[model samples]
Target: MKSLYAATCALALALPAAAAELETYLEFEKAMPPGNLAIGPDGRMFMSVHEFYGPELRVVEVMPDGSTKPYPTEDWARAPQDDADGLNGVLGLRADRDGILWMLDGQGENQTGRIVGWDTKTETLHAIHYIGAPVARPTSFLNDLAVDRDHGAIYISDTGDGQNSAIIVVDLETGRARRVLEGSQYTIPEDTPMVIDGREITLGGNPAKIGINPITVDPTNTWVYFAPMTASAMYRIPTAALLDESLSDADLEAQVERYGDKPISDGSTVDTGGNVYITAMTDNALGVTKPDGSYEVLFQSDDELPWPDGFSIGADGYVYATINELHRSPALNNGEDASKGIYKIVRFKSLADAVSGR
Candidate 1:
């Protein structure tokens, strides 16, 4: 269902003029594209270099002048050959209120998923949790994650095809993990074609179909929201119900709520007023879903936001997003990378104040 604001915005997109333009925060000229970003309380910007393109570095810190450097250390940014503990492939990252940066490593083709938390305040390791086997299957592409500090847990979206897709719950206190809602209707991708510019993106010669990719926790940590990259609706479940190991699959599914409708999206974040900001990838725009299930387009770009991927709200009350042109990647472009020069990290004002790292 289209909200009233969305209905009006849909009509606005029909006009030739631009709706809103994003402010350029950082630009990547010769570097690999960024996957996700997290802004610290002190204003430090950290981003994960997308692993889909086989980047040399896993993570980097965006300096004041837009230059990039290995985050924390060169060694940590570049994993030693055959070293599983090193930062292998990070995409989803967030900053806790305590200024601790949490990075989620899907481990690339290795499939050794792990979560690494770095204490920016003290320049130390806060925690490291490994996810494997029963919880992370061979086909699991651990995409994005949400840190529920209030519940002492982390919820990850396992976009393992559309059949085995599930939301993984990891206990922050004990590092135990369990896969819930595996292959449920809520977690699986809809039979929607991911078309960009009139051409459907293909992965391995077939139409790219991703399931339950964008995931985020609300400002109050009350609910974990997520959706399939090919689905049109956002779904959420209470943090309490997710943390309750006693709940069966059906019980967990019963608590799940279809929050609102959204376009094909990649990443998301929320503000203090329960507004969820999501990257409207198909439209090359940014949008938000309000507390009352109303969704509105905040901005739509003409040429700038080509495949806006991840979102992070900074302490300055701006929403930062990565534009990587993923549909042009080799995997999606029929074995030929069609991305042009310069990826970007852009920021726009949020409708409401937001938690620094989400």
Candidate 2:
């Protein structure tokens, strides 16, 4: 039998490269604009169909022939009515080394949120944890997440519509969760407008400002790196402090440190070498935040990458991202959906080997 690494390498070669540095892994029609994405241990790619398009299938598995099928099951992708495992609306998802896919359901302007884990290897439910009330408020938008199996915890970025943003830490063992750094400068958005393609993005006739949206953890799971979507700097906090229930909010705030400068980005993922690849939303590029707090662009294209929203490392030693034209959505385009061209999923080789699903 072939090894896992060898299998990944073989599958990667099936797709022809589109550019010198990037490969167009998949493309979709106008209706299936993708949100966040994850690749399983066996190279099966999954993504949440962008909620802005009001899709019937919320989560789907991208097939080898560029088609999509309801992930896990058709019922699980529909509205959460009778089936408890149904995904209401998912924006973020990640697959771990153990073959479990963890999906974050923000519930789309609803008051409650949830995290569901399914064991891909066994095709069975692994765990489900509800997040609401004290930890998540009515305005909470659970944008993205990072799984730290070493600490038995999952860190989420609650981009509370630019007002009450914070980091929510959930204990995998107890299912208890809490919000930290609430209303802090590091989590709230700066007074800046998001301008893409020479036009400022607006929602309801006002600038669409978002708080902490891009969040990721290093290969070792020692530090959590994050930043506000409208801000120009990245920050980090030790994972130990986030899981400690004894620490007060003030103590936790003290542990936060500015890691480096970053562009206005949407999602990020790290490699084994501590290099964080960030999606530069405004610049239409992907840049890396180095270990020494320096930044450089790895790839850029005006036509190919519009709003690069999510990031996930695959077993093939490549980082995958979704290029959805979110800025053209009705919410950001003043009540008119102006999006054109095919929604694309692209991949490029990572600078170093990565822990898949981070």
TM-scores for all predictions:
0.90, 0.90
lDDT of 1 by residue, 229-279 (tens): 888888888999998889988898999998988888889988776778888
Q: Give the C-alpha lDDT of model 2.
A: 0.85
Off by over 4 Å in 2: 1-20, 82-85, 108-111, 353-358
What is each predicted model's overall lDDT from 0 to 1? 0.83, 0.85
Model 1 regions lying over 4 Å from their true place = 1-21, 108-111, 354-358
Residue-pair clashes per candidate, as listed?
A: 1, 0
Candidate 2 residue pairs in clash (backbone atoms < 3 Å):
none
Q: Looking at model 2, how many pairs of residues clash?
A: 0
- Model 1 TM-score on a 0 to 1 scale: 0.90
Q: Give the range of the ten consecutive residues with the poorest summed lDDT in model 1.
A: 11-20
